[model samples]
Target: MSFSDAIKICFQKYMDFNGRAKRPEFWWFALFCVVVSLVLGMASSALSTLFSLATLLPSLAVGARRLHDTNRSGWLQLLWIIPLIGWIIMIVFLAQQGSSEDNQYGSTPAN
Candidate 1:
């Protein structure tokens, strides 16, 4: 998907974790989130508290979709409970490429 489309979908689904996402879609949205967070952090120091709290949902949504992209369940996030191993596994999973075509989750991301 295009960068703009990814950002749009990220917010459109904001909290959805059911569908699959491709690498471009996931990473671009991630970049959007990071940049937005930094900008918001600088622009509204007083509001940082609220923005920080609010960012959690979309961040989770992106992470969940990133998991789905790798053909893993979003529930894998719970693995974070297992000390360092879980975080490593999550990083590796996020780094891996999505299936080239469709898998059980859904169709390939829009071209």
Candidate 2:
């Protein structure tokens, strides 16, 4: 997916994490998130400390949507609670192919 498409998906789903996401869709959005955070973080760190908090909500929302695209419950994302293992698991899921033709959430990303 294109960067614009990924960002659109991020906001469209917002908090939904029960579908499947293709690789481009996930990574592009992720890149956007990181770039945004870095810029905002630098601004906050140098200017108002409080602005650093900006990344929190956006990050969660994007993460939840990314999980949804994976066909996994957003709740499963909490698996990141386990630290390294959780992180590894989440990465694996993101790396896996989306449902071939939609398992239950909606339609296949390929379609």
Candidate 2 minimal-lDDT segment of 10 residues: 47-56
TM-scores across all candidates? 0.78, 0.71
- Candidate 1 stretches greater than 4 Å from native: 43-45, 80-84
List candidate 2 stretches off by more than 4 Å.
15-19, 46-65
lDDT of 1 by residue, 1-111 (tens): 788998888788877887777777778977876787788778896566577677678768877887887888888888878899988987788889888777777776665
By TM-score, how accurate is candidate 2? 0.71
**Model 2 alpha-carbon miss at residue 9, Å:** 2.8
lDDT for 6 in candidate 2 is 83
Candidate 2, residue 75: the lDDT equals: 71
Every candidate's lDDT: 0.79, 0.66
Error of 2 at 51 (Å): 6.9
